[model samples]
Target: MSKVVLITGGSSGIGKSVGEFLTQKDFIVYGTSRNPENYKNSKFSILQLDVKKNDTIKKAVNAIIASEGKLDVLINNAGAGITGPIEEIPESEIKANFDTNFFGPINVIKAVLPQMRKQQSGLIINITSIAGYMGLPYRGVYSASKGALELLTEAFRMELKGFNVSMTNVAPGDFATNIAAGRYHAPLIDDSPYIKPYGDTLKLMDKHVDSGSNPKLMAETIYKIINAKNPKGHYKVGEFMQKFSIVLKRILPDKIYEKLLMNHYKL
Candidate 1:
C-alpha cells in the first residue's frame, strides 16, 4: 500500500509543495489548514487544523486515521515566524511564537504517536530552520523556537526507537515563500536604540527569502527521507553555505563564530 502522509500548515510554502509532490508520487496526502475551505483546489485533501489548537490537532489526526486505517508519515510543517530584537519583543508575542512553532508540533506528534506505535512503524519529520542552528541577530525568537524543536527531535528519536517509530529534523534555510508576509515583526520604533540595525537586518532577511531556493527543493528532500530505511536524526537542506554554517558552528571558536555572524548581519 502507498504510504499515507499528513502535512500540517499545508496551505502554502514548503508544506504545500511537499503535499503536491507526494500526491504526484502516488502517496495518499492530506494537508491541514486552519481554513481548509480556502484550499479546495489543492492537489491533495486539505483538513481543518490549527497547530496551536490541541483540539484541532486531535481532530485532524483522528480523521486521517479513521479514513486511512493508518498514517505512515507526518510532516510537522505548521509554524509561524517572528522577527525582532529579543529584548524588544513582547512577552506575549514570544510565547505565542513558541506555541505555534514549538508546542504545536509536539502536540501533533503526541496525537500521532499512539497510532504509530500500534503499527510498529512510522516516520515523523519535523521541518526546522537553518537559522535554528544558530541564533541570528534580529531573528532570535524564531531561531530559538526552531532550535528547541531540533533538540526535541533528538530526544524523541531515542524515545521512539523502541516503538519502531522514527523521527527526524529537516532544517531548511531561507526559501522563497510567503513566510515574510506572515511573520510577526516588532515595530521599528524611531527612538529605539536598535532601530537602524534591526531595520537593516530585517530588510536583508526579506531579501534572502525573496531570492531563496525553490520550495520544490525541500519537497524532493522530504521525499527522499521518507523512503529511507532509517532516516538520520537530522538533515539540513539549503545552499552550501547555509548548511556549512552548521558545521562551522561545530568547529569554530565561540567568539570567532559569533564575529562571523555579526559580520554577516552587519550588526
Candidate 2:
C-alpha cells in the first residue's frame, strides 16, 4: 500500500511543493487549505480545511480516512507571519497570529492523534520558521508564536513516543513565499507611536524574505524527512544569512547581538 500524507497550507508555497514531491514518491497526498480551489493539481487530493476551525479539521480528517484508511504523515504547514513591535501590536492581532501559527497546529495534532495512535506509527511534521530559534526585531509576535510551537513539539515528541507517533519541527530560515502578504494586515494604531522603528526592521526582513531560499528546496527537504525511516526531530533549512543569523546568535555575546540588530535596523 502507498503511504498516505496530509499537508496543511498545501495550496501553495512549500506545502504545495511538498505535496508534489511526495506524490512522485508514490504517497497518496491529501493537501488541505482554506481555499482548496486555489490550488488544483493532479498530484494530490485538495481538501478544504481552515486550521482555525474544528469542524473543518474534522471534516478533512474524515474524508481522508474514508479514502486512505490510514494517515502516515501529517504536515502542519498552515501559518501566517505578523510583524511590528510588541507594544504596538493589538491584542487581537497577536492572538490571531498565535491561533494560526501555534494553536492551530496544536489543534491539528489533537484531531489527528487518535488516528495516529490507532495505527501506532505516524509522523507529525511542523513547519516552524528560523524565528523559532532566534528572536528578531519587529517580529516579536511571530517569533514568540514559533517559540511556543518549538516547546510544544519537543514536549509532545517525548509524550507521543509511547504511542509510536513522532513529531518533527522543520525550522526554515527564510523562504521565498507570500507570507509577507499577511503581515500587511497587522493592526496599526497611531497612539502606539512605535511604527517608525518597527517599520524599518520589518521592511528589512521583508526584503530578505523576497530573495531568500527557494520554497522548492525546502519542500524537497521536507519530502526527504517524511520518507526517511529515522527523521531528526528538528530540521534546519536556511540559506546564507539565515544560517549566519543562527550562528551569530550562538557565538555573539548578548550585548553584541543586540547592538548588531539595532545597527542593522538603525533602531
Candidate 3:
C-alpha cells in the first residue's frame, strides 16, 4: 500500500513542491492550506487547515484518516515569518508568529499522535529554518519561533520512540518562495532608532531569498529522508555557507560568533 503523506502549507512554496514530488513518487499525498478552494488545480488534494486553529487541525486530520485510513507521514511545514527590530515589533505580532510557527505545529502533532501510535509506525518531519539556529538581526522573533520548534522536535523524538512514531526536523535556508511576501513586517518607522540598520538588513534578507536555492532541492531532500530506514534527529538543507554557519556558531566563542554575524549583516 502507498504511504499517505500530509504536508501543511502545501498550496505553494516548499510544501507544494514536496507534495507534488511525493505524488509523482506514488505516495498518497495531501496538502493543507488555510483556503483550500483556491488550489483546485494542485497535483495532490488540498485540505482546509489553519495551524493556529486547533479545531481546523482536528478536522483536517480526521478527514485525512477517513479517506486514507492512516497518515504515514506528516510534514509540519505551515509557518509564518516576522521581521523587525526586536524593540519595534509589537508584542502581539511576536505572539502571533509563535502561534503559527511553534504552537501550531505542536497542536497538529497532538492531533495526529493517536492515529500514528495506533498504527505502530509513522513519521513526522518538521520544516524548520536555518535562521532558527541563531538570532539574526531584524529577524529575532522568526528565529525564536523556529528555534523552539527545533528543540520541540528533539524532545518529541524521544517521547515518540516507544510508540514507533519517528520525528525529525529539517531546517532549510533561503529558498525562492512566497514566504517573504507573506511574512509580517513591522512598519519601518521614520523616527525609529532602528530604521537604517533594520531597513538595510531587510533588503539583504529579501535579496538572499530571491537568489536562494530552488524549492525542488527541499523536495528531493524530504524524499530522501522518508526513504531512510533511520532518519536522523535533524537535517539542514541550504547553501554550504548557511549549513556551515551552524558549525561556526558551535566552535566559535559567543562574542566572536556574535561579532561575525554583526560583520556579515554590516551592522
Candidate 4:
C-alpha cells in the first residue's frame, strides 16, 4: 500500500517541490493551496485549504482522511512572512502572522493526531526558519511565530514518544522562494512614522534573500530526513551561516549575538 502524505501550502516553493518529490517516491500526496484550482500538478492532487480558516482546514482534512483512510505524513509548510519592525506593526497583522505560522500548524496537528495514534505510526514535519533560532530586526514577529513552532515541535516530540510518531523541524536559512514576495508590508509605510528608523533593516533582510540558497536543496534535504529511520529533532539547511547561527547562539553571550544581528541588519 502506498503511504499517504498531506502538505499544506503545497502550491509553490518548498512545499510544491517536496510534494512532487514525495509523489515520485510513490507516496499518495494531497497538497493544499488557498486557490488550488488555479494550480495544477501531475505529481500530486491539490486541494483548497486556508490554514487560517477553520472551516477550510476541517473540510480539507476530512476529505483527505475519507479518501486515504489514514495520513502517514503531515507537513505543515504553509506560512506567510510579515516584514517591518514589530513595534509599529499593527495588531491585526501580528495576529495574522501568528495565526498562519503558529496556530495553523497546531490545528492541522490536532486534526491529524487521532488518526496517527490509532494507526500507531506517522511523521510530522514543520518547515520552520532559521529565524526561529535567532531574531533579527524587522523580522521580529516572523521570528516569534516560528519560535513558538520550534517549542511545539520539542514538546510534541517528547509527548508523542509512546505513540510511535515522529516530529521534525526544518530550520532552513534564506531560500529562493516567494515567501519574501508574499510578505505583508504595512500599508503606507512611506507615510508611517517609523519608516525612516527601520528602513535600512528591511532593505538588509531583502538583500540577503535575493542571494539566498536554492529551494531545491531544501527539497532534497527534506527527502533525506523524511526517509531516515531515525531523524534528528531538528535539521538545519541553507548556507553555512545558518549552522554558524546555531553555534553562535550556544557559545556567544546574548549581547554579542545581539550585536552580530544588529550589525548584519545594518542597524
**Model 4 C-alpha lDDT per residue in residues 169-260, reported as the tens digit of each score:** 99989887777789987553777777775776667667778888888888788788878997789988989977788899999999999998
lDDT of each: 0.96, 0.85, 0.95, 0.87
- How high is each candidate's TM-score? 0.99, 0.93, 0.99, 0.95
lDDT of 3 at 81: 87
C-alpha displacement of 176 in model 3, angstroms?
A: 0.6
Better of 2 and 4 by TM-score: 4
RMSD value for candidate 2: 1.8
Q: Write the per-residue lDDT of candidate 1 for residues 1-267, one digit (tens) a residue.
A: 999999999989999999999999999999999999998899999999998899999999999999999999999999999999899999999999999999999999999999999999999999999999998899999999999999999999999999999999999998999999999999999999999999999999999999999999999999999999999999999999999999999999999999999999898
Q: What is the descending lDDT order?
A: 1, 3, 4, 2
**Candidate 3 per-residue lDDT over residues 66-172, each given as its tens digit:** 99899999999999989999998989999999999999999999999999999999999999999999999899999999999999999999988999999999999
User: How does candidate 4 score on lDDT?
Assistant: 0.87
User: Against the correct fold, how does model 1 do in TM-score?
Assistant: 0.99
Pairs clashing in candidate 1?
none
lDDT-best of 2 and 3: 3
Against the true structure, candidate 2 reaches a TM-score of 0.93
Per-prediction backbone clash count: 0, 0, 0, 0
Instruction: Name the regions of candidate 1 deviating beyond 4 angstroms.
Output: none
In model 4, where do residues sit more than 4 Å from their true spots?
187-193
